[model samples]
Target: MIKKLLLGLLALLLCATAYLLLWPVPIQAQVWVAPPAPGYVGPHAPNTRLAGLQMISLGAEEGPEHVAMGPDGWLYTAVGSGKLLRMKPDGSELAVWAQTGGRVLGFDFDAQGRMIAADAMRGLLAISPSGEVSLLTDHVGDSPILYADAVVVAQSGEMFFTDASTRFGAKALGSTFEASVLDILEQSSTGRVLAYNPATRQTRLMAQGLSFANGIALSSDQSQLFVAETGRYRVWRISTAATGLDVRQASPQAQVLLDNLPGYPDNLMRGLNGKIWMGLVKPRNPKIDNMAGKPWLRELTLRLPRSTWPVPKAYGHVVAFSEQGQILADLQDPSGAYPEATAVTETPERLYVHSLHAPALGWRPNDLK
Candidate 1:
């Protein structure tokens, strides 16, 4: 009986090993070397500046991913519940501005004072002043806009946005978080940048081959578009007039503005004095980077318990940089009290911090000139 039990135990161990090593998974893992992440020092050193961030609660509606100001000066933000909310700058008179019935990850206003939104489930949308929601465009070529992450309306009535992934669209994959994980694990570079022309009512691809395109911002002169490619930890600058460009290749007109950021870059908001504010959602994980060259290992990791996945620990961080890619200031809270500091919107009086998973919007008094 003891001999039989030992043989059964060995068989079980072999089965477990086989399951871990040969299980079919969703991700098509790739091999690419990830740069070493720099430690938090200098301007990124630990500080309490963001520790005491004041909050404007959303009750059960959480995850203020992106915050914007309307032409009317009211504060606008998109929450996780597929609701667009508006509140006074002082956090008074909180009310629903519009309901898109789909999660809006990012949004911006057009020259005509219309609220243009990048809805992860609904594609590009234009929300009127009276709270009417309209779908702008959803498909490019034969492919639909899978994960519309961010939108920026240009002065010419044109719209530019980022499709975060093609392989695991939010509609097919069920959730942005799950889709992102698959895309990052695969690293197939299926993400792309696109543009919509209002007059023509047509959407066309601008650039392709990004791992996971996230935040977007127009240059001060409105001539260039700065995109945050999160999966690869870089920011790309592309010309508005350029079409069908590949960001991975060397080009003078379109190239990486910031490369190998220490953390996962989230959103881009134009701030004071020609500076663009960028949020770093989480610090880099060396273990994940080390596995970049080992595709099989990455696949095996996905087969493990989901909790064993190498998701980076939460660390509150944000930075400001110029169009030339010069990092101006870096703010950090290593304790991660604020949670997923995804972007920063600057007003003359304050700097509002946006998050991807916080129950409230975090803001602090702005003294930076």
Candidate 2:
């Protein structure tokens, strides 16, 4: 009986090994060296500045991912339920504005007061004042725009946005968070920035080859774009005139403003003064960085139990930087009462913090209330 049990155990071990090595995962893991982590030093050192953020209950709703002021002087946010919720600035008179039926990760008001949305599952959409949704563009040539992540309308009625990852479509892979994991782990860098002209009804590519392009904000003059390349932990400033630019290659048109960040960057929005705000969605995981050049190990990691994945700890962090890349404000909450603080929507009176999966909307007065 002891000999039989030993043989069975050996057979189980071999099967487990094979499963770990040969399982078919969504990602085709690629080998690339990740930049060394910057470990919360200098301007990014630990702080309690963002601690005890005041909350506004969404009642039954959650994940107020994108928060901003609409053209009608009302504060707006898109929850996980695909319902657009609008409330007065003081978080009063809450009402359901409209439902897109798809997640809107980022949005902006066009010159004509229409909301241009980068809908993760529904492509680029235009939502009229009466809450009617229309598809603007979802494909370029033969390929589909799988992940429309961010949108910013130009003065000339042109829209600029990001397609986070072409390989792992959010709808196809279940959720935005899940698809992002595959693309970042693979480092295939299929994300791209695109431009759409409302007049000609044309969609064209501006830049490509980003691991995961998350957020974008136009320059004051609209001459340049500040983009968050999430997987690389960097923010880039690319000229608007540069068409079909490859950010991986150093060019005068593309420059890395912030590099080797302490965490994975998320959304970018225009902040108070001449500053641009960015959110570090989650801090860097040392294990992920260590496995960056090890494609085989990365694949093996995917084979492990989901709970065993090396997900980073929640640490609320957001930064305000000048157009020149100077760090202006670094707010952090080590306790992480508000997880996944994505970015700040700054008004003259308050800084409304956005979260990817928080139960409530949080805000702090200019004086840090």
Candidate 3:
């Protein structure tokens, strides 16, 4: 009888512990998904009709962040080793164009064939076809460009770029995003967009109060510019026309073009077919998104090392969308291309993808009409 009584007490104690552990929590339990297999296909349906989704090696020794096509038909890309590489169309030969003082992020070639780059540590840079590097601007107004992220060239020679965050540099991007959630919970702003004039060699702030201003792309007509606000999961369109500018009477009033994306959007480029191609570093983990509503949870996640962090398998995709924000196709790592594909640029013959951690470049040849 004594043994039976002891067994009953033990069972009751276990039930009490379970109740205490789960009673205080109001949110649902987070579900963890396993990482994708070496050759995992995405859940989203592929637009098979849209061709040119293959992966080709770019022969880089380190991570490549962005790719741009020059007027000479050569592919220009920025690698994590702080070097710019110029590769032939077939990815056969490569030449180190310029070695910046820091990591290079985004780049675009001007009408004059000069390459303009947004270097994370060295600020804005200009590279000649002959591989000479020059520092363009380091600051806008009095604030230094903490993390110059992306750049675009206009027909008039004006350059637009994003200073991703004032709180963190490019080296700490992962941490910066984590900090952004905390700041958002506190309702703070720490990002900006700037413009540089080549003729006068002047840099000035064009927009402020951005969560994390990223890729900048001008509209086909040059009447407006789209700035990717990564932290807020949206793209903001800033007016460039005289009428819209005059009405705001301030830094361009940003209008949301797309919001609440399934993933964090990175480098954006205008496709040859007149669509916007965006690279998603990773998809939104619902647990992380929910935690972002709470500052403390966001802070804790940020402190965790990337290796220990629980990431969803549904991340990593290159999405193509129309100018009006219609999703055209969702291109994934069909051949297990890259772990973290960060940027995409289209040339007359192919589409190039840059990986953040992978040592090589991925390419898919275009379907000739």
Full-model lDDT for every candidate: 0.90, 0.91, 0.69
**Collision count for each candidate, in order:** 0, 0, 1
Candidate 2 segments exceeding 4 Å error: none
lDDT by residue (tens digit), candidate 1, 1-369: 999999999999999999998889998898887988776765666666667788888767889999999998899999988899999998888899999988899999988889999998879999998899999999997899999999998888899999999888887877877888889888999899999998999999999989999999999788999999998988999999878888778777788889888888889999999989999998889998898899999899988898888889978999999999988878777789989999899999999999988989999989888
What is the overall TM-score of model 2 with all chains considered together? 0.98
User: Taking the tens digit of each residue's C-alpha lDDT, what string does model 3 give over 137-254?
Assistant: 9887688887888999889998988887776665455333343334333323467778899999988777777666788898898877887877666777886532213212344355
lDDT tens per residue, model 2, 1-369: 999999999999999999999989878899888888889999998999999999998989999989999989999998888888999988999889888888999999988788899999989999998888999999977779999999889898899999999999988976988988899999999999999999999888899999899999999999999999998999989898878898888889999999999999999999878989999999999999999889999989889998999999989999999999999999999988899999999998999999989988999997632
Candidate 2, residue 11: Cα displacement in angstroms equals 0.7
Extract clashing residue pairs from model 1.
Answer: none
State which candidate, 1 or 2, has the greater lDDT.
2
Q: What is the lDDT of candidate 3?
A: 0.69
Q: After superposing candidate 3, which stretches have Cα over 4 Å from the reference?
A: 1-55, 58-60, 171-188, 241-252, 302-308, 334-337
TM-scores of all candidate predictions against the true structure: 0.97, 0.98, 0.77
User: Candidate 1, residue 222: CA error in Å?
Assistant: 1.5
